[model samples]
Target chain A: MRDPVTTVRPAAWPKTPALKVGPADDACNVLIVGVGGQGVIMVSKVLALLAQSQGFEVKQSEVHGMAKRGGSVFSHVRFGKRVWSPTIPKGDVDILVALEWAEGLRWLPFLKAGSGIFICDTKRIVPPFACLNRKPGAPMRYSKETPAEVVAHVGEAYAIDATDMAEQLGNERAANVVLLGALSTALDFSSTDWERTVAEFVPKKTIPVNLEAFRRGRGWIEDARTSTPAVDVPAPTPATAAPYRIRLDINPAWCKSCDICVKMCPERCLILNAERIAELAAPDKCTGCRLCEWLCPDFAIRVNLDAPEALAR
Target chain B: MYIETAADFDVTDYLRKEMMPHFLCPGCGHGIALRALLWAIHDLGLDRDKLAVVSGIGCAGRLSAYIDANTFHVTHGRPLAYATGLALARPDLHVVVITGDGDCLAIGGNHLIHACRRNLKLTCLMLNNEVYGMTGGQVSPTTSETRLTTTTPLGNQEPHFDACALATAAGAGFVGREVTHHVPKLKELIKAGLEHPGFAFVEVLSDCTEIFGRKNDMGSSSDMMMRQKSEIRPSAYLDTVDTPFRSNALPTGVLTRNDRPEYGAAYRQAASARAGTSS
Candidate 1:
């Protein structure tokens, strides 16, 4: 709800931060990782604005061109006395905020080893690419690490159900704002300043809901900092798909020797017999996509993808 | 639009069952195109009695007789002319005109343009076989340049007419082009045209395997169909998605669509405003 035009932050920036930049380092690098449309860039904008207002030069760079279609989206916000490179070096990210669970695992190597603060949402967004396996019982290609394991690996980590909390607040889209609220705790910014900046970024009507979401997220993180983070129930095992058989009925009496079924078949398993009638020569090669039946001008071809288990008498 | 599972759509349900082994030649793409039109009608859940399919004289014209619903087999190149009057008279009827390339673009060229100009609520499906198959294989307006028809023995020298482009230029509200090889895609295109409120002109690239293919040594019915499919590109994937279309590929799908005022609705509004009496 910022500018609704600029890909980067269009909201008013906060005034100051706690000045937590290490003496050995020149800037504080916070990496916000999430799938596109999760408001990763928006969170980075808030951070950049707060740092800039604190008299520290802020350099924010992001990659979100493919974010609109559920693609990987990440933004780097570095603020200090004078920032140079817009990108954070690998293993140098002071804090890593992940809007999605799998993406947090994917970008784990970038977090500063043994010291980086890891705040991740327990929301699982199985991408379209993960469902490519067509086998009956094949498992999806996704991260297998659980919250317990991920928390144990990182020096300090908090896996919160920010999405569910936002949904309970009556806006699933505010999930990103919730993640932002959790991120605000990792920085030195004041609570009131963070809330005011979030209010500016979000729509006027949803200000009340987002403010409550921010408080809930801030509370969840604070509780987890003192105790163990709660683990979510693992993803349900993929169900075995129905086993279907491709059955083709080609009526020779009606076939006009058009050779359409034989030639247009995607598998090229169809052939003309001695009488030049269409026949399923290699039945095993047919996938039952029904290209033969649909293209047959003579209406001599009929295909059925029947459940093999149901057909057993 | 949602794609219906093929299991739900049966071509025989909409067809006069006895008409099986239709007179169309082996591998004639018209049958496939006909199946798409019927599938669209079936998917739309249109009432059989409320549908009026009108056709002109050609291979495409014979399609009207096979439909189980009401149909009109009119004279050559006059299906659109007849459809305009029929649509105005009975706005409730889903008037669809089925005509071949020769029947639509050549003989009934004037009617085609005027139909576009009027922007009536009609779905005019022009099946472009590129030849007059029913008339013993002659050159048609959509016939590609340097193609062999009985009339063009030495490969046609005239450039083929882009039917969808013509309809678009003539001010048709909705215009689309699709191939018969992809039956489901063709059905989806036809369905979109049917759903349009104003004049919808769909040019289906069909094959006359027996006549056009044999005369041009175009291998077999499947070969001709595949060739046409390979040469033309689906309109939906021209941008963003990777496409098989090369430089010479003819784009398909709904090419032109606009919010032109439909003749029937405007006519009714005017008549009611003036007559001020119930019909």
Candidate 2:
């Protein structure tokens, strides 16, 4: 299998001819698919709101199966002069926004052949259950197919590293907005309308960062249209990485003893101390993936990239 | 105490008049549960100022909005935890929690068990409609075997939870069960629960007519009520059987009672003893 984290910039963008701005009588069906907590619902809400602003009747139907546990979730959004049903018929979806690579493949049957625009984020979330029966010392099971395979199957597909782009913009949770930015390029909507819809839908505090992420997504697509390949930086390796130790600082006054960060840390580097504030428990094991920092709702924990011990390392 | 006859029970004093008409469906049993709760408070003549109602998110949770008391509509499945804190901090106030089957038995099950074990002075009324009514009738923990729900398009294969048995096992000071069809009996159970000194748990078997009822072909609201009337058995009769709840006969009435030391009073006594103060 190909490297899962490798950025798969679309070789060419705007593959389809410019969409004809048909009258309100012509309806459009958009399908969004992702695992729970990836903000698939938020993207659909923005689309519905933008459709409504354009004086179109919008109907959105969402299937939330065991949400909050990384279960499969999808939404059907139909917008037109008159929306009769909340669900879009099979093989009638015009635009498909998949927040996960495999999920995009899962909904390939729903997309309109030759005409559908498939926008996917090249982030592979390996299903936990997929590894239940694996043998010890076996390779970790992930999506064997590449984004190129997905593009070939869908006929007209754009694969972008939305998660990496959002992380570059300071917050990884803004990946949905990045995909929305890429989606905005395929549609015949103005940037002003997309910005207004995003500002109205996203929280007030996250408006600035999310807007920047959105613009970066649009810019990526615009650059791809000119055959500009996305920057191909080699994946970070522990040896070649910045010779710095991961340092975590916890603001005790800000922490409410939630312990979310401690529980979410994949490296088991954090633990709640006697005072219930998060403290670095196993600093040597710290990989500095920033999962704890991103998952911390209180923003009480800060992971400093460069420590003074870097010179010694 | 002034209410002499059923017809004379004035519920307007207990309700938020501005919030009416309530948003319940035509035959929803939540209204019945709310009425019984109001009647219990009315009969006890408890000061409304000292009464606080806490609820999680569901159709039953909406009971907080309609009641003209200190009501807290908290997040889904955490009402019991919230009520535990309220009961401990302000021992003078009576904290009653209203929750649905999905809220109490599924997401909030851990809190429910812990609260029962703590034996805090709180009344928790669990309205079990066997389906999640607010979210369009998804299969809940209390949904009976072979029942139809939106999620369980086919019949539910899982065995249902016996909430009363669960509470009794969890060490609640008081445990009662009643159906919405028996309003007078339900009111009595609610009143008894309110008067109990420690963690009082009352499970009211209600119906979701629009969702569960319609899906199961259990005709209209009145039809479902008739089914409830026939299915329920007295607590005294239920005790004789080895498997009391193995069949369709649901036991209704106070199943257990004890004099466990309430958490708030016990904590205060322990703290005072540590400080060399007389209790």
Candidate 3:
């Protein structure tokens, strides 16, 4: 386990960036991102409603068709005195709130060059598209950039574990609301207004928990803003020094010529010989996961991870 | 508290040495299921003498003969009936009845229901292979619809029985189902079933590779195992509705569980109370 990156944000706010956008007539582009069913739209809806309550024209556009089955669902909420487009232009988002860690990286280019504040949950939701490498111990194609690296790239980044915090609060579904609370600190919205707006969107019974979640999320950012530093380089991951030497002791006496280990071997390392007995056709490819040893009905395959003859196949 | 790892579990240690290379067809999933059962027994640290493996006549029944424990290979469809009596007489022994689809559901249907109702402290593992393998691959009650067996030349028209559901409906204290593809998980489920206080019915969806696979064109044993793994992703222990594997497939895992009183102790308590009144 690596040490957490200490967050050392500036003590003073930079004139409240969204409030410096000239007037309420200028649209404040807010993009909320997460997987389907993570309440991405709900966060955007709460924001849109809050802006609309303040008498601003809000055009909230989202694609939630993939939400039912858990795809990358995003909502673009641009509100101003006279909002024209429902979507925000590329690289013009004032604030980007990501409920999932990987998704935050996916939409990093859309953030404003220097002043954009990124409030993101550090919970990694690796999409199914990234799960292409099924080989044992294969490094997954996820974002390798650490929180500190991402924080360095943006003007302000808060990598909070909102989902974990909400889970501890007995309602994991309130994670979006927690992120919204964090986002509230970025915008010039009242805590009471954020709570009331989030309360209106969630169920009547879950108001108290969601409100508490919002408070916790808001307090976390506040604590980070004053207390600590966040530029700690993440400790390097320990590389696999030496793979376990795998050896297959195929007891030919018990092998039933079933071809189970031959077919089911993910590495295709095992093959049926001319005698119809399973043999290690490719020793280099074996990872010693023991799929063959467990699936062998005849008790013919015995995988010795640390074989007696360590070097010999 | 006794933690046992799979590396320490030697299947040969629990098997009768004389019964080496047992008489099951090649690529049969029963052998995998047998390994899981033995592994579970090993994990529980149960004494060989204290364990009773009773089985009805079928390929699964033949499994009891290979076990290096107190085994009873009873007549077809009577293993549950016999196990119910043995468990009541000797409550100290851990009784595990291994029955197949035809042996348990079609012929011994009443026995299974009554056994569940009795809630005896027994672990009944029904290895549903969808066909009677020993008797020339005949159609069984748990056979999937349109699966080709020797008896179902045109295809099986009858709806299959979800054994776990049936046991749960009959009020068995613990009901679960798992496939042979996930051997370790199957062992864990069996271990849980064994540890349950009251009656536990675990349905192991096995593959009769030689018979079922060839006839149904279900590919090799490896393909069959993959199909078992993919065709039915085991649903959550309690969340049976969020099924994503197949639209119409029955959910697996510990489908239902309750804290019902065990029959053996409950019966003895009631009998002693009545005897006290009579005296």
Candidate 4:
């Protein structure tokens, strides 16, 4: 197995085609669309954070359907000079980053002419209704109108089966990261920015595959840039602020290394010490989502938000 | 020796301290229930400083925002849990919970039943309007069977919950019912509920003129109130008895009033016993 975090090319940001519009022009609006449980909201949040780090005003709103079961989900992410509404009007979206190919078509109405980019994975998830009604499953039919095909037919498109790529990389859910890898080229963001975003958004247990998927996407973008002049976008400056500040801490004395804390750490920051106590592997990577503290069986690993001195020292 | 009438009772004074302006519709049952409770508090002469009101979300949940006393407006259906926590933490305060039927039985029904079973020292008033008035006329758990609502246009199929019966069965020390129009009876029930030593449940059948009236043709407030008095007669057998009965009949007076150690006091006793053993 790959050494999860170490093998990830954190610094491997190969130069791609740069698109620099003057600062006065508004930053383009990108919509990330997917079904519930497919991590569209996480991608939107990371995109929002990424945009903010690049000194752009960002506003985002998520429309979650009946999320417990397989349901249609989408997020409106508007980031530019002055974003008023969190919604992207029809036919105005610049980049549509879809985790699934069918989800890309689900949001096809918002694609603009000439500049619109549809970055998608060829994976298919048949919604429940299509299965129960004996109707032709939306998935089999949807693959034909792939994001790449749609974008190419309308303006520009990049289509890859990110799911197969991530599965080959040994993680299936990292499909979104693989698509994100494809998206980094269109947006002209750095690899460090992608890694930082992944470290913050994707929990620790799945980080390895997610990082690999991102690398795969970034590589695809680099290779594609050689063939076609990449979309005109300026390089995003690295966030100067100590960006990956972690808030959760583990108490070495109390933790029995029960693996519950490690399993529950959404950011995958906690590791086992010699004495079987859960310890922080990447203290800076903790986003303080606090899923670990809520699910801890032993109450060992604490979200040390209450004591500033203990955490700061 | 002097006898004074209720005319001297400043009902608004019993408002659980610094009350806030709220979103209750004019002449809403919740407003009447609040007035009756205040009158009861004044009649019982309870200390204002020792009062704690816990409410859940709904139109009634707005009670927390208004009261001057320590008030907790917890999540819908979770006020009892928060109230349980508060009652345990501060046993000295008179913990009173004001909740709507939908807020209590439908969402918070589990907590309400458990609180009664545990016999915690708290007074719970369930304001039943037969529909979820705040969120539109949705059919609520306490909504009467065959009643029309926004969600149940053809009429509600689900049988309404008898809060008093549920509480009595759950071992609450006191359980009673009264309509909002019967302010005197409502005040009496509220007083008894508050004075009870353990968990007390009082159901106040109220009017939802905007929803129930609009749908069921219950008529104007006065006509509806008059109907409430005429239609709702206290169970005859209960009128004669001084003590409460265990049967789940619709009686006017106190249904069940029995002495039982509250959950918090029992928990503290157990904790102290362990401490004593260790020492």
How far residue A70's Cα lies from its native spot in candidate 4, in Å, is: 73
- Deviation from native of the Cα of residue A249 in model 1, angstroms: 3.9
Among these predictions, the greatest TM-score belongs to 3
What residue runs in model 3 are displaced by over 4 Å at the alpha carbon? A1-25, A65-70, A127-138, A161-175, A216-228, A231-239, A242-247, A282-288, A304-313, B1-4, B105-117, B139-173, B225-248, B255-261, B266-279
Q: Which residue pairs collide, candidate 1?
A: A36-A67, B146-B156, B147-B156, B235-B252
Which lDDT tens digits does candidate 2 get at residues A162-272? 999999988999999999998887675689999999999888999999999999989887776567354332322223344445667676765655454665566667888
* Local distance difference test values of all predictions, in order: 0.84, 0.80, 0.84, 0.70
- The residue pairs that clash in candidate 3, if any, are A6-A229, A6-A230, A7-A229, A8-A229, A8-A230
Model 2 segments beyond 4 Å from truth?
Answer: A1-313, B1-8, B238-248, B277-279
Model 3 misses residue B156 by how many Å? Answer: 5.2
- Candidate 2 chain A has its poorest 10 consecutive residues by lDDT at A3-12
CA RMSD of all predictions? 7.3, 22.9, 5.3, 25.6
lDDT at residue A95 of model 4 (Cα atoms): 80
Q: After superposition, how far is residue B138 of candidate 4 from its true place, in Å?
A: 0.4
Tens digit per residue, CA lDDT, model 1, B59-116: 9999999999999999999999998899999999999999999999999999999999
Evaluated at residue B278, the lDDT of candidate 3 is 100
- Sorted on lDDT, best first, the list reads 1, 3, 2, 4
lDDT of 2 by residue, B1-279 (tens): 322434334555677867765677655777778878888998888899999999999999988998999999999999999998898889889899999999999999999999999999999999999999999999999999999999998999999999999999999999999987666778889999999999999999887878999999997665787688788887876668676653668778999899988888989988889889653
Backbone clash count for every predicted candidate, in the order shown: 4, 0, 5, 10
Supply DockQ values for each candidate.
0.59, 0.01, 0.63, 0.01
Q: Candidate 1: TM-score?
A: 0.73
Candidate 1 chain A — worst ten consecutive residues by lDDT sum?
A1-10
